[model samples]
Target chain A: PSSGIEKPTVKRFESYKRDSQLPQAIGELRILVDYRAQSIILPIFGRPVPFHISTLKNASKNDEGNFVYLRLNFVSPGQIGGKKDELPFEDPNAQFIRSFTFRSSNNSRMSQVFKDIQDMKKAATKRETERKEFAD
Target chain B: MAAKTVQYDNIYLNLSEKPGKLRIAPSGLGWKSPSLAEPFTLPISEIRRFCWSRFARGYELKIILKSKDPVSLDGFSQEDLDDLINVIKQNFDMGIEQKEFSIKGWNWGEANFLGSELVFDVNSRPAFEIPISAVTNTNLSGKNEVALEFSTTDDKQIPSAQVDELVEMRLYVPGTTAKEDAADGEE
Candidate 1:
């Protein structure tokens, strides 16, 4: 199971063939919700700029192939909002996270639960279109 | 814009560096673990303040949470912390089931690299502290990501942010000539 997480293909755009009109100035991003191969493409739910997440340097899996590790940098979408709550971290929005991934490149583990990493690119494109008309 | 949600693997505080403070991110290697559903990242786009200092033991991480609304989720009471932990753990479980990282774009992580750190920040106090008692290097930077291992309260030497806002969208579409490039590559 040393092949924990599958080797990542070139971490590039969601398949330009699907949408060949993207500009380089940067408009939207692809978010691949990959849970052991199953991936889903989530369109940014809010804001002109949909919240974007992507893999940074690389993803490493454990020797047992039961775990996958990768460094991903997140870009928070909007401005500062809300007051401090009675929690350890004052920002109420700080801990009220709605979604994220716990990835393991573990190969021994078969069958991921998410839809498919291929859809991540689609999610980004959808955001670009939505942002053209919305903000949150 | 709609409400944004993210997730993390660990929730920790910096004892020796910033005094009284805590941060929540994921436990996976690389910065991607903390990304949200459409997947939000812990980018330092809007963040203005950050620090990583050395102390008697390992290091200290400090970041300020933005206060925009009337109620902030920073510094919880003992009960709140417990509740928070439970909630996060539950979120973790729920995420595993959904296999979407986070259902609503949020993720949670608990410190797992071993070592120890005592957090010392109450309600709204500025300086917070943790019990990171491992001797180590402590630096700060925006471009650098946290180490790619199961970090304990000790093995940390990276810059922290009061808050970092990464761009919501990375503009995924390729240039107009993208198809040509792909086609070329395939050929």
Candidate 2:
């Protein structure tokens, strides 16, 4: 108590960076369908704000068992099209799927939605560990 | 002709009422204010969307009045519509309540996009319906050829609560413009 040194338990507005490869925070993905074509777009929120659109694959309304996946990294807010990368577009009609009636997505409530996914992953990991131990 | 029954493609809740989380995902309610309704009027030029922009994705807001078995179910009663209207009146301010919405984007301040303003009350109760009629051109897939949402908002978070509390009601306007287009050709 006599020493003028303080404990380093406080955080916020300060930090030190090290070799950290922690997972990234995923944002929302938007999907839209035109008369005969479909387009997918990703809006990333981070350091380098990137907007990517997909080429219209032979897509339609009734087609199921399909997915449009996107990853967002490095998006600096308040800036337009911050340095970023993207997948090529399949839809020919769109310069980039500008905007359209947003189709359905599974991220309505973000917090619990993503949390459930993470939880399932953890459960899978635990099961995998158990199975390995049993084999040993 | 009998009013055909419409099935909704999506039905979800919005918890923007939680403290500090201003705009709910999917249907970002606050993307633009009611006054901007002026600039969104006709002769479409691919302008900015009011609130239903991509920034507000993943959030679902709807107030559905369904009747699977009209005799036994909570039928689409006049009280139901009025109740929904009352919910809208309380959530949004006076500016929102009077912001006239139409099935056409012709006159001034008419909608040119497919979205609605889910005005929820400070008590986390959904209270308004800002129907968007500019959704015709969009070729959205699924049962709800058209989409709509209902929202409940609050200034603070209710501890241990779920997202359902934020979006207290819902309704889907499917092929809403299909009927409007038929009327558009005439007076």
Candidate 1 DockQ, CA atoms: 0.02
Chain B structural similarity (TM-score) per candidate? 0.19, 0.16
Specify the poorest-scoring 10-residue window by lDDT in model 1 chain B: B178-187
Off by over 4 Å in 2: A1-38, A41-136, B1-11, B15-82, B88-187
lDDT of 2 by residue, B25-93 (tens): 222122222223321111112212211111122222232212110000111222233433333334331
- Tens-digit per-residue lDDT, A22-84, candidate 1: 222111212334332222323221101112233211122223354432223332222133213
**Residue B14 in model 1: shift from native, Å?**
21
State how far residue B11 of model 1 sits from its true place (Å). 21
Give TM per candidate: 0.22, 0.17
Off by over 4 Å in 1: A1-67, A76-105, A108-121, A130-136, B1-187
lDDT of 1 by residue, B64-87 (tens): 223210111212222333433343
